[model samples]
Target: MFTGIVEELGEIVSVEPHGEAARLAVRGKVVTSDAKHGDSIAVNGVCLTVVDVEDEVFTVDVMRETLNRSSLKSAQAGARVNLERAVRADQRLGGHIVQGHVDGTAALLSREPGELWDDVRFSLPRELNRYVAEKGSIAVDGISLTVTSVDEDSFGVSLIPTTLELTTLGARRQGDLVNLEVDVIAKYVEKLVVTK
Candidate 1:
């Protein structure tokens, strides 16, 4: 598990095909500082195990199912990704419970900039619409953000200057796709209600 708090903005060093899967090497100094083989790290909201660790780079394999369900399918050598280590039991839950399991991808609809913040809109997937709500928490590209508003087909989040400068969402443009993970608590509640 993770807290959806980005520890560093890592760059994809390379991605190579390995039969039906792809091996990805990411360059991140902070996240790889103490990383070891078999350690789990959240990359753009997807939990990936560390297959190898060398210096400031760590490698993980992306299977076909993961590639098809997240934005990683189009990942290139120069793409920037949000990186976070798995949360420790002793650490405080600063953001929220994030399983690093992406529900789906959302397209960047638009960005309305302000002097100190920006309201970014994204096209919410129809199947996941009911799981989102105004003022609820949503993980976008692994960064935890609060929903400023929600409509039938889209949702908006306010990003402060810190977020714009520290994470991948800052550079996202119109029509770009991003990985999204809805609040797991909401899904559990729904399941319990239906079963009851």
Candidate 2:
């Protein structure tokens, strides 16, 4: 599991296609400091296993399912990605629990710049809308953020100066696609309620 706290802004070194799947080489010094084969890492909100680690770079294989579900399908060399290592049992849960399993991809609908922050709205998928609630936690591109507002077709979040400076959300523009993972708790609650 991850806490949706970004550890570093990594760069993609290369993307090699293998039939429907692909192999990615990413350069992340911090995340690869102690990483080894089989270790899990969150890349832009999608969990991927480490296939190899060398010279501060790690390689991972992306399956077709992940490609179809996330923005990673269009990932290219030189792109920046949020990186996070799986949480250790003794570490604090600074952010909300995040599985790094992106539910879907959403596009930035608008951005309203403020003196100290940016209020951004993103188009919400119809199926995922029910899981989002105002003030609830959500993971966007592996960074934990609280929803400021929610509606039938879109949701909003306020990005503070730190968030704007640290994550990919700061540079995103209207029509840019991002991976989103709704709160796992909400999904569980829905499943239980529906079964009753």
Candidate 3:
């Protein structure tokens, strides 16, 4: 339910552990400006519901499943995370549809920099190789990007200056872990074809 366009780079305020969950507080200006209890927000590619709201800060309860599937487990105070609110009906679809449901995490294999751009290669789960395609859409850390190329074991995406400055990807280095969500449409198509 998000466009994958980052609204703001929010910082983690705190991470507190509960029985089988963790409570995360984030400080964001744009996303929290109109956020209320029960609103959905994407933090580092994971969609979480708002349980509490204060000025420039909102709290969300991260269940065990979310922690296991996404990058939130390693999240700490002051960590810069990409934030995006649910897409509105009248707004333009600037980025592809991102459900905030991360399929798995990928490791940054390498980064090649250019004068004003960069290409980052990532090693994804081998099982997901079937879903990724060249020129297809992929969501990394809640930012929508196109697959510049795909190989048997990995993929690469070119990041422009705007993407570098607006999201957490700018801070990533080799061996860094990032949450990834593949195109939902591709998954559905594959499912139908397999059932035939």
User: What lDDT score goes with residue 144 in model 1?
Assistant: 91
What TM-score would candidate 1 get against the native? Answer: 0.98
Best-first order by lDDT:
2, 1, 3
RMSD of each: 0.7, 0.5, 0.8
Candidate 3 lDDT over residue span 1-196, tens digit each: 9988999999999999997789999999999999999999999989999999897999999999999998898889999999999998899999999999999999999999999999999997888998899999999999999999999889999999999998999989999999999999999999999999
Instruction: Give model 3's TM-score versus the native structure.
Output: 0.98
Q: What local lDDT does model 2 show for residue 68?
A: 97
- Each prediction's Cα lDDT score? 0.95, 0.96, 0.94
lDDT of 2 by residue, 105-158 (tens): 999999999999999999999999999999999999999999999999999999
In angstroms, the error of model 1 at 20 is 2.9
Better candidate number, 1 or 3, judged by lDDT: 1
Which candidate leads in lDDT?
A: 2
